[model samples]
Each structure stands twice: as structure tokens, then as C-alpha cells.
Target chain A: MSTPFLKKDKTGICLKLHTALYGHDAIEQFRGAYGDGLTFVRRGAYWILSFADALEEDVVDSLDSLLVLSRNRKK
Target chain B: MKKFIKADGWVKVPVQTKAYPLQAIYSAGYVFMDKAYLYLDLEAKDKVVVWLKPKAKADLDKLAMEFCQELLNYAHYFSSLKVNAESTKLLLQRALFSAAPSMVKEAEEKEIQDLIKELEQEEEKENRKPVKKGKK
Candidate 1:
């Protein structure tokens, strides 16, 4: 809600999060929750989430926030 | 304040492993897990690197200082725990064993009664069996 994720202000197309930071469990949690419409690719230490369709900036931010929430819940 | 490496949207805080143990670092990292995105890596055999990326715009210097302080706090805690571990374990064992004797006695009594009943039933069955007539 504070601001958009750093992706040139167009963060809906694709998303990248360092796996070491948020962890693989977080991505799996995201996949179980919001991954039906997204493509997931694990490239080394990063998880790249490609959207299936064009989404609003706020929606993208919400998904990112969800990813963070999943990370917290993973503990 | 130690020199916090300035970077784009993130700061690198490095600590010497010789100064603080890995457990201390991990404990500090856990405290900051919800507050920031932490990526811990070993730069060398003796250097621990922590990359702290805040969710919002904040002072990187302050974050780094806080992390260091947390690490120190945990290190002290662990040391104190180690110092008192023997007495703590002894006290906990005494607390648990204080109630265990009665519980164990009751369980053993029940088991012995069940065994005695089974033996009595088997003996009764044997007594009730008709003795086969043997050649005189």
C-alpha cells in the first residue's frame, strides 16, 4: 500500500525474488495460493513469477505482499 | 557506526565470524525476518554478510546498527544460557520426576493386576480340564 515494487513502475509483467531471501517455501505457498494464473520459473537462486495476464499495479503489489506474508508464516 | 556499504535499495552489513558466532547471526536474522528481506551469506571463512532490504524507505545505517546490536544481544543470551544449562537441566529434571514416581507406580500396579488376572484365568481353565485316565 505504501508504494509499488521496483520494476520500472511496471511490475505486473514479471516478478523476481531472491530465493535465499524469501525462501523456496514462500514460493510454494504463493503457488498454492495465487499461482494458478502465473508461471513460475526457478532460475538458480531466484524465483521468477510471470503473470498469465496483464494485471494492475496494485494487484501485483498485493501478490508481492502476499509473498512476504507467506515468508513470515513459514516460520 | 561501522561503515555500512551503500548500495541500491539495500545495504550490506558484514560481521566477522570470529567476533560473533553463526548462531548469534541466525538469531538476529530471525528477529528481522518480518521487517526486511534478509539474505545471509558467508563472504569468507571468517566473514558473515547480511543483506538487509527494507520494505519501505528507511535509513540503512540505522538498520545495520540495529542488526549488529541484535546479534550482540543474542550472543550474550546464548553465553548466559550455556553458563546456566547444568542447573537449568537439573531443575527441570527434578520438576518432572517429582510427579513421575506416582504415575509410574500406578501404571505398574495396573500392569501387575492384569497379569495376575490372566494367570488366574489360565489356572482356572487348567483345573477345569478333565484329567485323562491313565493305564493303572
Candidate 2:
């Protein structure tokens, strides 16, 4: 019922992002985890993952971790 | 595609005949109401006044149906409901969230948890009933 990804404005801007995991490989990995119902979009700084089913909690956690890892790679 | 200018000064983007992105169009509406804070504004402003046209209601409805159908296809695969309750839940969530996250609305994680509970209940009901055995 709920969306696979939730959009938020970390910065107060007129934008509602459907951000998922980051990086090309990370996004692909996430799609593989939840079956073939997802479509990953690469937009600027984030990856948008669309799933027909509400993604499982574990999937979200894994994605969050992946993003953290991606962010850390820059440093 | 003719770039028509609206009376209220918004340059209306042409709806492309060749495979328009459904998400982008619908996302615009979400960004307007949720991110732009238009709906939350205290001013008694109306979209009708701006000439965006009330006719877009039909287009919006059609887009919603398309989105739901796509959602239903995916939902049927994992859903436990005999009548496809998971698809119905997806429709409900879209209406509530408008495809955007807001602090005022309940988190999507919580919504997913609630839906899982409903699915479990449905599964329980199915298990309670007995299957008839055939005579040899």
C-alpha cells in the first residue's frame, strides 16, 4: 500500500523527490532484491526506485545503508 | 508542439504525443501541493483563477487510473487477497500521500506495517476454512 520510497526536502525547496538508493550499481542491486516490479531512475544526485508493492522494511534498511556507504565514499 | 502561454503567465508545456512521462506530470501536481506549500497556504487562492483549466480533471483521472493499473499488476504478484486488496491499498496510499512525503502525513513505513497486518488477517481467514476431500 505504501510507496517503496518516500520523498522529502532535506532542504526547504519546491521539490518532492522520490529518492531511493544512490549510484547506478546500488540502484540495480535494490531492484534485484525485491523482484522485477521496480524501475530505477537516475536523477542528478539520487536514484528513484519505483515498486508496485510496498517494499519490505529490510529492503529500505539495506537501501539506507547503501546510501550511507555511497556518501562515505566521497570522503 | 506549440508552446502556449497561459493568461496567468505560466508557459504550458506541451503534452508530448510520443510517450510522455506519466510520473513527471503527476509529480508536478504533488510538488505543487506538497512541496510548494500551495495547499497549506492560508490565502483563498484557486487554481481555476490561473487558467490551468478545470478540464485537466479528466486527464488527471485517467493518469491516476493508469498508475493504479500498473500498481495492481505488481501488487497481484505478492498479495494474499483473493480480491486483490493490495492494489486497493496502493490506490488509497496514493490518494493520501499524493506521491510525496510530508511531515503532516503518516510515514510510508507505518502504512506498510499496517497493510502487512491486514494481509495477515486475510491469510488467517483463508486458513480457517477447510478444504473438501474427494471420495475414492
Candidate 3:
């Protein structure tokens, strides 16, 4: 079965990111950049970013870099 | 700590915060950012589940082992940072503190120059003022 963090359904694959870890600002920045290709929704503590197709490694790395940048700035 | 499980496409590593703090986990993940696609989940209050998918097709066992080593590297690095934090801060401050007097001196010299210029301008103005001629 698909996990809460990663899901695959009829629509496509969606990744849920926790705001507490990555923070809201970074997620918003990621959304701003990827909003055209992705759908971002807030269910609760997590922001679920959905993609129509399976995400490539670069896309995932982009998010990872954003989160790390945010975390580093906060520190 | 040696436990590394290989799933269909991802390698799952369950880390305990007691052994590997969250900060260390983030640090470790950062180092592996170029190597893998990472997904983090909360397994428990103190346990973090790290899911890794290698960017290239490679040995899962070796990849998992490297990740664990990366975790240990960061864990020690962070703890050492904590231990040296005060001294590091003080050393940095001391270095800046030593350099500050020269900066302060430069500012003081500029201020003195400005004051001298103001005084000279005032003197010039005083000299330029027409003196009232007294009846001889």
C-alpha cells in the first residue's frame, strides 16, 4: 500500500511534506516555482504536492535543496 | 544501528533520535542529496524513517551501509560542534574583538578629520567677517 508520505493513485504520484520539518516558507517557495506543473494542497500539517507524472530525480532534488536552504537559514 | 532493509526500489533506514539526533539526520541527508532521492517519515516519536532511492542503479547493500556511515559521521560532527560551540563563539568574537579597535580607530580618525575641517571652516568664516572700523 502507498504510504502517507508517498502515494500513487489513478491521478498520479503525490508527496506529502511536513511543514514542521521543512517549514511553510520553503514549501511556499517550492510551490511558487513548481505550481505550473504540480498541484499543492494543504490537508493538515503537511502540504501534499501532486504531480501528473512520476517525478524525476531533479524535481525531488529541487525540493530537497529548498528545504535544506530554508533549514540552514533558520539555523 | 546496523539494520538496513532493501525494499523494491528504496532503502529504508529507521533511525532513533537517541542515537542519531534529528539535526544529524538532516545533515547526513544533505550530504547524500547528490547521491539519492530521500524521503523522511516519522516512525515513532523518537524514530525517523529515512527512505533512500539511489539516483543510479547500484548495490543496495553498499548504498545502505554508506548512508549509515554518513549518519554516524554527522552525529559525531554535531556533538563535537555542541562541545566546541562556546569556545568557537568566543574565539570568533575574540578575533572580531581584536580587529574592532582598528575599525574603531579608523572611525575615530575620520571623526577627528571632520571636526578639524569644521573648526577650520569656522575660523575661515571668522577671518572673512568684515571688522567694524573704529573712529580714529
Candidate 4:
């Protein structure tokens, strides 16, 4: 049998499954299957992110703008 | 029966490279998505192919993420200069095994074990089949 997905090396950013807004339940279900590594949160509209560390301050700010731009484009 | 000669059929070619490291990030992402939905081709080399047959949602998702990273990495690496086909191939293999080395290794190990188990099960089943009786 294949070895279950376990934390390999606790170094780099932990793999996170990010999804669109409507994908919350799907992300949550995945969290249940994979463990607590998954997180649901809001970005521009909404996003699911998992990472070893929060992005750099500038990156966060840029992402925020990008999210807003994306939201605007949708409408 | 009549003897006949057969000719080889045409087949789509596959490309094997990590990603070109000089394209727009968003456009690169789209290329990855397209390839995932279709096939990965090596346009430089007789178009050799490489792809993963996702067995589960998790597997598919992970592969998508890896593709994203490869595109990002490729763009980052080559934005300043031109990359040859040889270097491109190496970069892609690195991307493949680098994204989730542990996961890929685990999967390969599991696949080997599963194959062994399957062979054993087939052997057991063969031993259990009833033999046909000849006419009395």
C-alpha cells in the first residue's frame, strides 16, 4: 500500500490547497481528508491558502490589489 | 488466411521540459492548465511526451500545483537570458521531482508494492482454479 501523505520535511512552505470562493466546502472536505493543513479565508473575493509562512508584506499587499482587480473584472 | 503488411499509424508527439522561464506568469499558468487538460509535449525534441495519470483528486490537484510552480520557476529563471533546449529539459525534470519529492517517492514505492501484491494474488487464484476433467 502507498504510504499515506505525511509531513515529509518540515522545512519549506507546507503545501496548501487554494481554491475559489465557492470551493469552501470542497476545501474543507479536503482538509478533513488531509488534516488541518488546509485553511479557508477571504482574499479579494475568497481564497483557500496553505503555506509555511504568510507571504512577504509587499507580496500580501500586491495580492490584495490583484484580488480586488480580479473581482472588478468579474463584474 | 492472407499475409499482409502493416504501416505504422500517426501518433501525437510529446514534449518534455519543465517550462520556459521567460513568459508572463498568468499566461504560463494558462498553458499549464491547458496541458493538464490535454497532454505535455516537448516541441523541441521530436515532440516526446510526459504526463501523469491522476488517480485521485488529491493527485490531480497536486500535479496542477506542481505545474504552476514549474511555470513560475521557469519564467523566473529565464526572464533575463535565452535558454537552450538541453537546459530546458533539465529544468523540467528538476521541476517534476522537486515539487514534491517525498510524495512522488512514496507513490512509486507504493506502486511497486501494489504490483507485488497483485502478482501474488494472481498466483493464488491460479492455484485455486478447478482443473477440467477428460472424457471417461
Candidate 2 C-alpha error for residue B134, in Å? 99
* After superposition, candidate 2 runs with Cα above 4 Å error: A1-21, A55-59, A64-75, B1-136
The whole-model lDDT of each prediction reads 0.69, 0.38, 0.76, 0.41
Candidate 3's displacement at residue A45, Å, is: 2.6
User: What is model 4's native contact fraction?
Assistant: 0.00
Ranking of all candidate structures by their TM-score, best first = 3, 1, 2, 4
lDDT of 3 by residue, B1-96 (tens): 465776667788888999998888888888888888787766677777888878888776788889889999999999999999999998887687
How does each model score on TM-score?
0.51, 0.22, 0.70, 0.20
- TM-score, prediction 3: 0.70
**Per-residue lDDT tens digits of candidate 1, residues B15-111?**
8878787677767877776666665555666886777777677788898898889999989998899999999998886777676878567767999
Q: What is the TM-score of chain A, computed separately for every candidate?
A: 0.65, 0.42, 0.69, 0.32
Clashing pairs in 3: none
Residue A4's lDDT in candidate 4: 18
Clashes of each: 0, 0, 0, 11
User: Which candidate do you rate higher for DockQ, 2 or 4?
Assistant: 4
Structural RMSD, model 2 = 22.9
Give lDDT tens digits, candidate 1, residues A1-67.
Answer: 2222334223345566656555688667777777566677788766777665545444434443544
lDDT order of candidates, top first: 3, 1, 4, 2
Q: How far off is each candidate at the interface, as Cα RMSD in Å?
A: 7.2, 15.6, 3.2, 14.9
Model 1 segments more than 4 A misplaced: A1-23, A44-75, B15-26, B33-48, B53-58, B78-87, B103-136
- Using lDDT, give the best candidate's number: 3
